[model samples]
Target: MREALCQMIERLVREEPGNRFPGEGGPYFTEPLIGFAAADDPLFTQYQTVIGPFHLTPTELAQHETPPWQPATVICWALPISEETRRSNRTETIYPSRAWALTRQHGEAFNSALRRQVVQFLVDAGYQAFAPQLHPAWREYPDSPVGIASSWSERHAAYAAGLGTFSLNDALITPRGIAHRLGSVVTDLAIEPSARPWRDHRSNCLWYREGSCGACIGRCPVGALSKEGHDKAICRGYVYGAVPEAVGAEYGVTSTGCGLCQTKVPCEGRIPAGKVSPLAVKPPEGESPSP
Candidate 1:
């Protein structure tokens, strides 16, 4: 099932034209990395404190369809932005590049469609599946201390699924780095949970570990980031305010995005080498590092 899901994502990115850059003519996302977690994983409960009490559990979500007795699995994935998009955003100091703005808008359209496709696939396979983000009950509390937090955080789900860890910018730093988007589906499929290689949630981030790389802090033109961490309100305002307008004027599309912090950093496309904690074990020969 894991192989099948991975193949499906690869095919979707390769075949979906909407995943392509508007005029740059390339896929918005490279191949995605997928992972799984037990729906009842205690981590989900901990997230309630970290995110909010409003966070939904898989069993709660499963009750929306199947009976509560049914077991569930959460499938999460990291969709890394293409090098083209990453490169373009890296060149910008303040706002996102036109290519990135378009990718942010259109790429998300593809992501939404992909979520539906995955859910349908599971349903067709005789399992009850739902994307919490797609649920009518889904909502975001933008005023939360974290800023723009949702009932179902894809980054958190991805972490539970062993996809990645949180970065200084609060972006999920997968093996493919922070230049990526994430998605998830909760289902009664009961797939084995992926192994989380790191012990701590912020283990993969260099800034959180060695405190040596704060490139993302400098990348924020609005000073939304600092040694203390990110100021989500300021960052959100910049991305949702003047940045989109400028990008729209240049690209002829009103798309809001400012990923300057995600690119031109040590963790842009891969885990920063030599930054892993001393206690972290190297991957066995012939195996790729966890994402």
Candidate 2:
């Protein structure tokens, strides 16, 4: 079943025009591996441990098979490449204007179609289909005991799934090494998870994996990411004050977030060869604010 599912994912990726890597990337690639999940997998515990304060909605009790039912099935890891992925080309134009440009370029129509195809494939094969729930990371309120929206860090998931580990800049390092946008999907149907987690490989990149790259720490105009790590308070202060306009300029809109670490990290040079397509970002004056 796992092998078949993996094959199906590869097929969907290859055929979906929208799935094409940014440029005319020849083909979408998949690792020669799959991950399995048991209800009791230690990975879940590890996920919580690594992420610190976050929550997972109760998937077990939330199952309602009635209409409008959208139960999650598989935990998928997705990497979306943005302008930050390419450092060799440092022109401001190199970065994508939007965070979800890769997914949005295909249009909702194509994304829906592709999702349906994959979901149907899973269901027909007797596996329940599911979608990823973005775990809580940044919210306006303090952390709560109840399951919050945020899950473990995307980087942590990749690392736990054995895709890669955390860099000093706090990015996950995959063989591709570049920080493509990443997401996951959790489902009800059980399957064998990957035996060799990304942690085993470890990132060879000096910036993220090796903890050497601190460019982002200094580049943060507001000092959100500092020598000690992310200073949420300092960052938020700017978001709510005089720098609000500048924040919007950097990130696209006036939101209380930043990506200084993500953009200036080491993996910028390690974009995967699998991604051959050219990404498009809006032309900007110099640098944009972080999200």
Candidate 3:
């Protein structure tokens, strides 16, 4: 099942001509990494606290269906932005490079298509499956326990599936790195959960380990990031506000991206080469992690 899932993703990102960015450009994303998890994983339930109580668990999301599919597995995958796209974005100081903007606009569209195809593939195989983000009840919450959050977080879903861990920049640092997009599906077909090698949730992040390498912090144009961490309000204000005004027409994409922090960093394409900082085990006992 894992091999089949891997092939499905690779074929789409590689052979699908539509996978390319708009205009005469390189592919939006490259080699994909897939992972699986039992829908009943306890980590999903714990996200109610970490992300917000409003975040939906797999069973909760599955219940939204007609007869309610009995979800047994959660399939997750990471689509790394193609090197061509990342290279372009890495050169920019503020606004995302044109290629990066197009990737965010078109690349995400490809992700949505991928989700639909995965669901359709499972259904054709006589198994019930669906993408949570596509569900009608799926929504973003502005008044949740977390500042601004959504009903189901794909990053958290990937984490539970053992695809990656959280980073100081708030992006999931998968083995392939932090510069990628994630998608997942819930199905009745069961598969063995992927192995999670790290000891802590933020173990893959260099900053979290030894309080060193705040590379992403320097990349932020709005000072949204700091040694303390990311400021959702500051980051969102720029992404949803300034981006539309400053980059709207210039890039031919609106409110799509500014992933400066995700590029030109140690963890951009792979786990940073270094020793772990014992301090990054987890937030001190009383402090909760920001979504």
Candidate 4:
């Protein structure tokens, strides 16, 4: 069943634009059932210890924190960075070939299409889906917890969904590789979730091992990411500062801003590098691929 579902997801994503990244692409799909019931539950507190801390910190806006009680599932649909996007943005030049770049021109549109498709898929599958940002930061707003902002990190959703583990630079990497955009839907429905793949740090990609590779940490124009982890101030400042220039120049308009991280990881290109896609999933039964 897992392989069947994996094949279906991989096929759909391979046919889409801007999903392939650098190394390989997975039709990797996860249903994080645990997150869905995490709100107000002690059972999940221990789960957090296992999965690692949620990215929210005290410095973040009150509306952006992950709610202690909002138990939701995440579905990730990703692609590779395109050569044209890379050339246009000089991502290859900037990162020195560690990551792949997607043409900024198509990045936003492509991401939107993927997000919509995922939401639609969830609805069709009999689950309630929301952008997370649309919901209140928490059930109580007067004295919300730290980093309790309205916009939750899709990255957390990706992580909880078992898409990948965190790198020193704070980016998630799949078995396929890193450099992907993530979108998620929080739902109350109980669905089967993806099994945890990485037992510990040992199973993660080798580039993460200290001193072995620092493409992500070193590539940052600002020294935001490091051996300790991401410096949120440095990261926010750089990304926020870059957005105006990127928008003025009509570069990729992903709300998350500059994709320098995506450009530096050596993975399969977002689009298929070869004639075949590494992880294209076939449609279920007689159903055809969604447009």
Candidate number with greatest lDDT: 3
Which is the winner by TM-score between candidate 2 and candidate 4? Answer: 2
Please provide, for model 2 over 105-155, each residue's C-alpha lDDT reduced to its tens digit, 9 standing for 90 to 100. Answer: 342334345446655677787766644332222232234332222543444
Q: Candidate 1 lDDT, tens digit per residue, 1-291?
A: 767777887899778887886664889898888999999988887777777777777776666663444657899988899998899888888778877887788888899899999989888888778888898768888877556777888888898888877888888888888888788898878788998876467777887777778889999999999988878888888888878766677776677588999999989998886545612475322222111
lDDT of 1 at 202: 75
TM-score for every candidate vs. truth? 0.91, 0.58, 0.93, 0.56
- Report residue 231 deviation for candidate 1 (angstroms): 0.9
What's the number of clashes in each of the models?
Answer: 1, 35, 1, 50
Two-way lDDT contest, 2 vs 3, winner = 3
> Native-vs-model 4 lDDT?
0.43
Off by over 4 Å in 4: 1-73, 83-106, 124-126, 133-151, 201-211, 250-256, 265-291
lDDT of 3 at 246: 89
lDDT of 4 by residue, 1-291 (tens): 334334445555556535444346422222111212222223233333333344232122223434333334444434444444443334432322222223332444555555566556666766555544334442322222422222345555554555655555556656545555555555444446654444432224344332345556666766776766567666665565554444533333344355565554453232112232223243112211100
lDDT of 1: 0.80
Question: What TM value does model 4 have?
Answer: 0.56
